[model samples]
Structures are given as C-alpha cells and as structure tokens.
Target: MNERMIRLADQSGRCDLHTHTQASDGMQPPAENVRLAREKGLAALAITDHDTVAGIAEALEAGKQYGITVVPGVEISTRAGGKDIHVLGYYVDPQHGLFLSRLAELRATRAQRNEAIILKLRNLGIDITLEKVVAGIGRELKPDESIGRPHIADELVRLGAAADMRDAFDKYLADGAAAFVLPPRITPEEACQWIIGAGGAPVLAHPGLYGDDELVRGIVERSAFRGIEVYHSDHGPAEEARYLAMAAEYGLVVTGGSDFHGARQGVIFHGDIGSVTVSVDVLGQLKS
Candidate 1:
C-alpha cells in the first residue's frame, strides 16, 4: 500500500468506490461481499464487475438488506492505442440496450477465449480441465456470465495444478504468458461512450498499470472519463501523485477503494471508507 494511502486510511474518510463480487470474478457471492463491506464500515461502494451488471442487482439487494449504499457499476475492458484499458462505469443503468448487448458479446467472446486457454493449458501438460474450471464458477455465478481467469486460477489451485491464483496467472494466464487469451472488444472511447449512454460516470481504472504515460494521458484526453482511479492496490506513491494531479488538471472526480474481493485474494482493507482518504464529496461530484 502507498504511504499516503496508509495516512489517508488513518483519517477516517467516507466511501470505497470500487469493489467486486462473484457475479463477475470475485471469490465471494454478492451477499457475502456486501456483508464484508458492511463489516469494513464503508459508507458506499460500487460492485464494478467485469463487463456485466449481473452482480449489481444482487449486491444492491444485499446492500439494502445490510443498510449499505450500492452504486451499480461495471468494469469494461477496451483497447486504447492497442493497449488494454479498463474503465469503471459507476451508477449505471442496468437495462441500457447497448451496454447489455456489448456485455453479451464480450461474454460470448470470453467463453471462446476460455476454451482456447484451456486447450492451451492442456497442451502444456498443466492437468487443467475445462470441466473443473466451469465447476469452480460457484452456484451464484450465472450461466451467461463471463468466466474470468481468476476462476480458472482458483480451479488450478483446487485441482493442485498450481499453488495459488498468482502462481496460476504467472505460469499461464497473464497476458502474453503461455495460454493467455485475448478478448475481442471495442476501444476505450467506445467503452466510455457506452457508459455515458447508460447514464453512468466513466472513470479510468488504475492508470499506473498501463506502463505508458503517453498512452495514459491520451486515453484520459480522448475519453469522456469523469474520474481517474488514483487509489488502487497496484499504485505506488509516485503513481498516485501523478494520477491525482492528472485528475485535477482534467477537472475529474478523484475516487478510491480497497478493490476488495475476499480472503483468498492477497490484499485486505485496513480501513473502511477511510482507506483512500478521498472525501465523501467525491460521490456528490460524480452525480454532477
């Protein structure tokens, strides 16, 4: 964690804008994820599942039951300058036509890609079976849901093919790694436009992960992004400062979160909403 983030977490702020649930790739189910969020004492959260809002409804219901605020969301993967960029769309309309269609297409592509990955793993003598991976989706994941590498990684661990999620990815699943699968998707601008059409705030997620400063700035300048995710597990102090400065220059909202998934995932939240130290006022700015 960034030192400044540690200081911010100490300040007792409000809201964790990014989160995940089993509706996408998270280990926990929506209800369980919400319960953990409540336990963490977050004032607000967004279940930004990858390419689908399937988890949001359940998360929203769970949040309501637990007296926590749920901000409907999805994390879309898109290409910007030939590099993959993920944009988090928050407070989205779940029923948006284009959004749903695009997600459906992406999910279909994911299934095919997963099959290819499984075949590649098999060829590599990894002992990974597609049936095992499919079975690892858990009961809460939908039939039409996009299966992520995390599920595959978990299956690998379960089947003794790999030690843990990180090992599985490092050995096979990471981009450009052996058995890596690519999804056919739209550009980052299209993703931003899709989110805007869904009446949501489109924010670039983890700019530090892009590894290209010029590409990062170009994406921000070209897209209708409402915010930049400065607070993330991958960002260091220098990267956070750079992103926060960029956000300010672009007149965008600055949001942060624990990016919490569950226990199996390495990092855990130290402070509830206070972890990022972003003011509760950021939510108001998002609405505007």
Candidate 2:
C-alpha cells in the first residue's frame, strides 16, 4: 500500500476510483474534476477517462493545487461473449509505449465507427454529419477524446430529431438501433493483460450494469483482474453486497467510485464525491 494514499484515505474517509473528463465523453476538464473532488471533501480521485490517459496529467496537477490525491487511471472498453465489458486500470503509466499505441489504434477505430454511424443515420434520412455532431457537442474533438454515440445523440437532439440523449439512443443509436455500429472488439482477458503489462491494477467496472454475474465471474476466474468495483453509484444495496461477497470469495481488492461525468448527462447518477463512501483501507488494498 502506498503510504501517501493510505494517509489520504485515512483523513478523508472516501475516494472515487471511477470518473471521466472531457478527454472522452465527460462534461468537464480534468482539472475541474479534480477541483470538484476537493470540494466534495474527497481524499482521492481517479481520472478514469474512457480509453485515454490524456486527462491524468491535468488532474494530477489540480490535485496538487487542491490537496487531493489523484490516481492515474483509464477505463478500457472490451468485449466478452459478444457483450461490452469495461475494465478500469488504476495506477497506470500514461507514457507506456504499448499502451499508447493501443490507445491510438482504438481511437482510430472509434473514428471509423462514428463515421459509419453517421452514414447509417443519413441513410435513414436523419441527414446528420460529423461536423454537425461535433458542433452539437459544442467542442472541437480532441485527439484524446474518442467520438462515440453520445456525441451523435447530442447531434440528434440539436437537430430536434430527439428530445434528449436517452431518447436519441433509444431511437437510433443504441445497440440494434438503426444508426448503431458495432465497436472494435478486444477480449476482457486481453484488456486485463494490457493493464497488468502497464504496471496497473485491472478492475471490472460496473458489473451490475452489465446484467450478468456469470460473465463477471467467468472473467475473474479466467483472467488476472485485481479488483471489482463494489460501490458504484448505480449499484443498489443488494448489488453492493453481492459484489462485496464476490470480492472476498475471489480475494480481489475492493474499489468504489461515482463514475462522475460532470453535467453532460444532466443529473449525476453517482452521488457526489463524499456521498459514495469507500474506506481508506479498501484504497490501501488496491495498492500494488
């Protein structure tokens, strides 16, 4: 366990391990997310932006300024049994060569997927363009930010084709919807290996959201993941207990986070920083 992380956790009684920033689909920049963690009285915050570590540096800088501990992390999207599975990599080296190369390839794949979705939408007479979608999202797409269906949904809303993001996803962007495009696939095992290779702890993210305890169990049994996210904002009391039991059964580390995405989705689904409680001892257990 890192003594510094242990001390921080001991002081604040809470930490958020899963969070996003504008580097991906989140609404705020990394620094702002760190500042919010400080305001929320959190001892530590992890900037687990989707498939990218571009936000970690800024978050770390902001953490220093705000007196909060920033855990360097990334959320990797992968597939298993045709289902989307997300792996959270904590304590990652952002500059790892192989990791950087894989991220670039994933980003390129994401761009292609976005283009295909737009073409499908146009064929369905939605008449949307990538430029319009970018404009709708109100930000120039950064290299670190992978353009995904959320941005497309934003475009749909801007065009008055849908009332909101959820509506847009329901109508055209969700899996099996008209504009849906299958994402590039990587296995959960491969994802875990990558995280381990990068000298980080790989954790299964939001098992409850995926609706398959068996699949999560299969991954844990077959792969090298070090932890499970036991305290997600979306996890109910029952779900939390279930994962907690699983963690103990597997001898895996326990982690919790708000999955904060800022205001992009309107209401924050996970409670604010201090609200979702995970003890410092659990944070210590995550130390490599």
Candidate 3:
C-alpha cells in the first residue's frame, strides 16, 4: 500500500468502488480517471469498465504513480427477468485465460449487435454505419472495447439524425426503438461464477436503479455475490437506507462510487469524482 494513499484515506475516508473509462463507453482514458480521483482526494478507485479489463493495467500503473489504490475491476452485462443486470467484479486477474476468453465472446456478440443496429437504422432510411460511429467517437474501438448504444447515439447526433444522445435514443436506439438490438449476455449466476473463477469478489451493481426488489432478492438468494453497492450517485437516502439494511441482513459487504463517465453525458448525480464516498473498510472487505 502506498503511504500517501493511506494518509488520504485516513483524512477523507474516500473510496469510490465504481467508475468507467474509454476502455468502454466512457469519455476519458484510464490514466485520466486515476488523475481525477487523485485530484479529488480519493484514496482508492476502481475502473469497472463495461465488459472489459483492458483498462486495468493502465489504471494500476497510474495508481502507483499517484499513490492511490486502484482496484482491478469490470462491470459485466447480464440478463435477468428480461431486464439488463450489471455485476461488478473487484480484484480480478485481468490476464486470467478463462475471463479473457469469456470477455472476447461477449465483445464479438456486441460487435454483431452494433452491426444489426446499423442495418436496422439503414432500413428505416437513417443512413449510418459502424465506421461512422467509430469515427464520430474520434477513436477506433479497441480490441477489448465493447461497442454500445452510446456510440451509436453519438453517430446519430453527428449525422444530424438526432440533436443529442438522449434524442438519438428516444428516436431510434433505446429499447423498443427501431434501431434497438439486444446483444448476447450471460446470466447473473454465470457472471458471479466467472468473477469467482477469475479470483475476484462479485457485487451487485446499483440494485436500487433496477426497480425490482423481488428480483434483487432472488439474485442475492441464488448467486454468490459478496457485496452490494449500497451507495451510488443515483441512490436517494431512502434507497441507501434500504440497501444498507439488506446488506446487514445478508452479511454482505457495502460498497459505493460515483460511476463517473466524464462530462460527455453530463452530470450523473451528486456531482462527479468524490460524489459518493465509500469507506476504506469496504475495500478491505473486498480484498479479503
């Protein structure tokens, strides 16, 4: 552990267990995310980019330079009850062969979905292509980066088909829209198992936002999750209280984060980095 990080943690009790970077749909790069967390006085941060661990090495390297603890993490997309579920894995081995193979399969499926969405948009007389979307984003999709609806929405905005990301989604890219395409995903149980196999702790991400308490309960009962994200930028006091009670009842670790994706999508909630404060105890629990 870095001594400076220890001092910062003692002073602020700041630990953000969730965040994103350009390894996926986030606007900033992994190093920039680390720098931002350091500037904001965060003692620890996790780069839980969607479906990819490509950013972890960079984040860990940056963390060493910044004297902040960077937890290697990934947020996986899973399917449950016809709704999307996200499972966060912490302290994962990015180079684990099984995890890498599974992620590659998911990314391939994501590419297929992106192409299908583009075809659907074209069929609707809205001309767009995967290349255009990549170009609009100003970066080629990295090998491990999973193309998502946000990239499609950005292309739509560039093409003048929609005013902005929300407009693009409302017009043709969101679920039930003309250009919508469901990508392949593992189940919640499989996601938890994968994380365990990769030597990580699996946590339920943003259960309050799912709006299905029974479903959340069912996952907790059926899966091997070790933690619950009790504090998030989107969770209100009531929601946080309820999750806290649930965590205690289940003897699960409690985690929190800002889920910051940068300024492109605007303010997510409380503010940005340092928005949702987490206890360093949570990090210790996750590591153990």
Better candidate by lDDT, 2 or 3: 3
Q: Please give the lDDT score for candidate 1.
A: 0.77
The TM-score, computed over Cα atoms with residue i paired to residue i, of candidate 3 is: 0.92
Query: After TM-score superposition, what is the CA distance of residue 164 in candidate 3 from its true location, in Å?
Result: 2.0
Looking at candidate 1, the ten consecutive residues that score lowest on lDDT are 267-276
Using lDDT as the measure, name the better of candidate 1 and candidate 2: 2
Q: Lowest-lDDT window of 10 residues in candidate 3? A: 2-11
Candidate 3 lDDT tens digits, 1-288: 542234335436578888888898788889998998899888889999988999999999999999888999999989898778999999999999999999888878878888899999999998898888888778776778877778788778778899877788898987788788888779999999999999999999999989998999998999999999888878887888889899999999988887877765463422377677677778889879
Tens-digit lDDT string for candidate 1 (4-33) = 645455433366777777777776777776
Clashing residue pairs in all predictions, respectively, total 0, 0, 0
**Cα-based lDDT at residue 63, candidate 1:** 87
Predictions ranked by lDDT, top down? 3, 2, 1
Q: Provide the TM-score for each candidate, comma-separated.
A: 0.90, 0.92, 0.92
Once fitted onto the true fold, the runs of candidate 3 whose alpha carbons sit more than 4 angstroms away are: 1-11, 265-271
- lDDT (C-alpha, whole model) for all candidates: 0.77, 0.82, 0.85
